[model samples]
Target chain A: MRLLLVEDEKELSRAIKSMLVLSGYEVIQAFDGEEALALIENNFYDGIISDIMMPKMDGITLLKTIRKKNIDTPVLLLTANGQVEDKVEGLDAGANDYLSKPFAFKELLARVRSMIKHYSPIGENTHISYGSIKLSIATYELAGKESSIMLSNKEGKILSLFLKNPTQIIPFEKLVSFMSCLDAKDKEIELYTSILNNKLDAVNANFKLAKLNKGYKVASL
Target chain B: MSIYGDRLAQLEAIVEKGKTLIQEIINEEVKTSGISPIEHFKYRIKCEESLINKLNLRCLPVTMESIYTNIHDLVGFRIICSYTSGVRTVANKIISNENIDIILSKDYIKHPKPNGYRSLHLIVKLKDSDVPFEIQLRTIAMDSWASLEHQLKYKREIKHKDLIVAELKMCADEMSSTDLTMQAIYDLIKEEN
Candidate 1:
């Protein structure tokens, strides 16, 4: 998963980013809300974690602005103050959840996982269809018209991502970033792509993962 | 020969701890309400074979990390109450506890399943453990119906499956109504005394 973490404290941001990275999440750090907003405009994030207090813009204002723009990305707000009013304001401004500053890292990780699991469109459904292929996210089984094949967790995630963005070329960097491996190499992704292609062939899927210049896209067979 | 032998043992310990914690909460609720809301409770740690089967069904690798992240009900508790109100009382007491974190709560009693199953499900994690567990609260009547329904679900190649399912739904509805009436009677008796 990819996350945009907006925090004004550089030291704390670094600490959190490292921890998230170790937990198989690709984290983009933004020192202030405006920078975070700029990143959000150009990129897609699985979730956003932001501190309430920031220099250029506060988290609440950023949240309100994003909501006004019809961006429904799940957001978790972090605040130094543990006041009920702060949490209420954050939720009122479109935050999905909030955490007080003096929180355990374990709690933060759990909350992040919960928010993403609850908010993801694919998370709510058992199966998703692209072309003539039906993929069960719950079972990691991809079914075509004639047959079906089970996929490894990594392969399932990659296929799910491709299916979610059928028309776009997903960058190799983004693909590698979301993989569980901390030091995932391009070759490893290539191997996974090959395995996925073989599975598609096995199941007689009407669509295949086509390699682009520096990315991959689902193409009609 | 199971790779998860140690993990299963750990989970059993956690289940024991969870049982004690839930029993304490139930006892405290009894003191405040002048009667125990829960009629009885049972707890279990998921066995190795079942865990492996679940992992394989989900196409997850049979690894410790996969179990930790993907499975939420390594330990499970079933609390059966004599009345529907008792189920709510026990659920509220557990939810209000400060010692455990509530990960998720589903009130199937208010909005029951399509098959008419009724229960309150909770996923919780204790303060000291990173592992999450499940708690299910249901009235005695609902429990009875669910137990039978579960049996019917697992029976392979049952004749007249649709008819049996419809009958089961009707039975669940009757049981639910009876539970409500029983709770009303209990309340009236308490009022008279």
Candidate 2:
């Protein structure tokens, strides 16, 4: 899945992005709230992880703006403070989840997974069969008519996202945002495409991962 | 002798004594209590020195009021941990001693300040020492934001004091969240490990 990680601390952002990439997620990172807002406006993201203390704009303001735009995407607020009032404020401001800083990578992953599962389109089964590809959203398992391979979460989420929005070009930013939910450091859009290509190749699936003018597309070949 | 020289001399003597006291207490804690070497070093030694330097300011009074009211150079230690829960761990550990008097206590994590600052403050008197020192415990993120805010607020125009204050308060709130999230993340990682 693609995700947008909004954070200002360069070292921490880099660390979080690295962790996400290692988990096989495509991530897009923005240093400030304004940048995050612009990315949200220009593309679609499955989730957003934002830091509250930032220059240009703060996380609350960014969340408020994203919500005002009527964007239904799940947002997770990251703050240094774990005050109940702050948590309440974030929730009231439209954050789907909240996490504090100096966090462990595993908890973040769990929270992101929970949030995605909670916000994912209901009635959509984890198991979906289209043409020769049988995708398992829960375990990221993929089985082609002729062969099968364990797809990375990123590869599986990409496929699933495409399955949900067939024929639509998933923008690079959106992919980054979705992938960030699993991990935020892997914002290298190019790397995810390559990884997806490799996974798809291994499964020998009939789906085509294509790069559009500004985004990516999953086409059933 | 100039008043400035006398004050500086007094501060220097107090800092010297404070450092020695901190080291002694750390040694005692290590000998008697369950505390990590890093925590002992950070909470007792480093934080104590930092507080002394911060509090022994030229402006603030050097009398008892400095120890009770001021958080800067007059304070003796400020341990910035990774979580709010850790504050109690440190506090309970420190207050276990029979002689250390807990003169004042504030759990800002449980009840945050109106400005959204989150920290635990303690004023305690050492058994043998007549002077009381201030201790402020917060998450590392909170401490970082607070330090940054202090640096920023003093470096430039004084007109944006209100704006800076609000921003700092917001930052403090964010830091508190980060502390909890980090603890959760750490616990998750630990479980996986």
Candidate 3:
């Protein structure tokens, strides 16, 4: 998962960023809300954690601004005060959840996980389907009319992406980013695509991955 | 019969009760304000197949306990209003009720989806039940746009998908502008009266 950590306190921000990175998440750090807003405008993150009290703009104002601009990225607000009014204000401004200061890192991680899971479309749905095939996200099984095949984790994730956006070409950059494999080379992605195509053929799936100019899309056979 | 058959029935009952409660609130509001905020409402309980699929997707054990704890939108209500102002008014009244506990509120109307879908979504629990249900409030224009967008979005085959998506977004923006103008005209007529 990719997360943006916005905290004015440099030392605390570093600490949190390091911890999240260690936990297998891509973490981006911004010193204040303005810098964070700039990054937010250009990039997409699974979740954002911002402190309520900041130098340039407070987290509440930052949140309200983003909401007005129709950015629906989930936000978790951090506040020094644990008062009910503060929490109500943050939520009323569009924060998904709130955590007070002096919280355990474990709790923060848990909240982050919950927030991302709740916001993800795949997390809410049981299976994704296109044409005559279905892929069960939980089991990593792709079922065609005649048979079903167990897919590797990477293969399942790749197929899920195509299944979710059937007929629409997913660019290489987006496919890699969505997989959280920023370091993956083009050849590596090509190999995975080929393997996935072979699996589809084995299972007699009605759809196959077709390469476009700079991306791939699921096309009916 | 599946083990969850009884649980599904129970959820349906909860939805029925929630609808009745909301109707009562609307009735009281109309009695005093001389106008109804809600143009119409629709309610549903999640189907058994979907419930099972959701459980499997989350990797949760297929048990009644898991359903109660993990699922929040087993029952849902969609409220359609004639204008944007009516949407807010209806939402305010529903949240003010003592019998409901607001667990989450997402003002998609203020912060719409990137695709331009707009609505105010609330996840709440009735006082008598631990089950949480979702309430969606949107103006007629928004409802119509969202309904059509949802249908087109899930289709497997479409030529010029990007163009269709852009056109839908344009339509949504235009409808929203129209809704605001209609609201402003209504306000002016009310002032004159």
Candidate 4:
């Protein structure tokens, strides 16, 4: 995914850019909203994260301009202000989500992933839920109420297939069809599934992956 | 003249105004009447990609006229409440409005679909704007059920579509009962206090 991060602080911007790049996203930086708008005119971004306070232009104004141009790119506003009204203003101006300053890095990543998942091309299949565990297919993130962790693309697809057909014993053949790895053996499947199960345990997810007669199924913990 | 631009502006206005009207109603009625009927509300305009995909899928001409006449759900507002009574209450507010005409209403809550889909869908036209849009009133359980059903329906490939549909239909029926039981418990608690 390609993302545009607009922030006035160069140090903070670079830090965020590096973090996003590490997570397999192509990111571009803009110092202010005007620069962001110019960059947008020439380049396309799957999502945008803009600071509400900026030189020459602010995030809210940029949101207005983008919407006025009929570009429905998903925007996540980063604001120093924490009031409900300010958040409401951002949303009313057509922002998809907002994050407060001094947020944890994990929260920022989660919000950015949320924006991307919400605006991704296969928009309908982006987010899926089963009970308390919500999965974002675009971001490869499985989020429970108390915690969340990112998954590899293959793991995400595998978990998603089970969630879609909850309580059903997915046969090995059926599970293999969901994986793109042609030479995926049973041992390799166990490795990926173990990683997913460990993450689920960390998150205290109500569901667990367990072996059925032939394949795996998700059962309540 | 930019007729297309003007139409887009009108649609935005209808969406903004409709949201404000509903919000104001909830603010006033919930405060004075001591009953909070709405859990949450959201509005959306069909994005360009989805619109184009729909036009091609339907084999419709890519013309503004075709869109204006047939794309009744281009602008959608979903109002979710906690109980069935709240659905009727909110729908009545829209129906009784002087400047709004109810083009038609699908009473799915009273008579659910064969697949156990239940929600109240109203197609309405504003008197001054002359644009038709859809408003969906549903309980939270119904909304959740519809979302899951939507996910099931939109898969590009499914090995057993019939089996999935059957399972989803059964889940929807169970959810409807759960909603009724929750509403009853809420009523009992309110009566006690």
- lDDT winner: 1
Reference interface contacts recovered per candidate = 0.00, 0.00, 0.00, 0.00
User: Tens-digit lDDT track for model 2 on B11-80?
Assistant: 4554565456556655665676444322332333224445455567546654445643554334356765
Q: Score candidate 1 by DockQ.
A: 0.01
For model 2 chain A, the run of ten residues with the poorest summed lDDT = A179-188
lDDT of 3 by residue, A1-221 (tens): 77999999999999999889999999999988899888776565668999988989889889998866556679999988657787899999978899999899999999999998887435456887767778888876666664454566767788776765453466676667545455656655665676677557645677788878877877888
Tens-digit per-residue lDDT, A1-221, candidate 2: 77889999999899988988787777999999899888877666667888888999999999898766555578888977567777788899989899987789999988888887798631257686655677777766565554444555655666676655444467766666655545543334655565555445434667767777878776666
Docking verdict class for candidate 1 = incorrect
3 or 4, greater by lDDT: 3
Taking chain A of model 1 alone, its TM-score versus the true chain A equals 0.59
Which 10 consecutive positions of candidate 3 chain B have the poorest summed lDDT? B180-189
Give the poorly placed runs of model 2, Cα more than 4 Å off: A1-221, B1-75, B156-163
Query: Which pairs of residues have clashing backbones in candidate 1?
Result: none
Error of 4 at B75 (Å): 1.1
Off by over 4 Å in 1: A1-221, B1-3
lDDT of each: 0.80, 0.65, 0.79, 0.77
**Location of the lowest summed lDDT over 10 successive residues in candidate 4 chain B:** B180-189
Candidate 1 residue B22 Cα shift, in angstroms, is 2.2
Error of 1 at A59 (Å): 67
Docking class of 3: incorrect
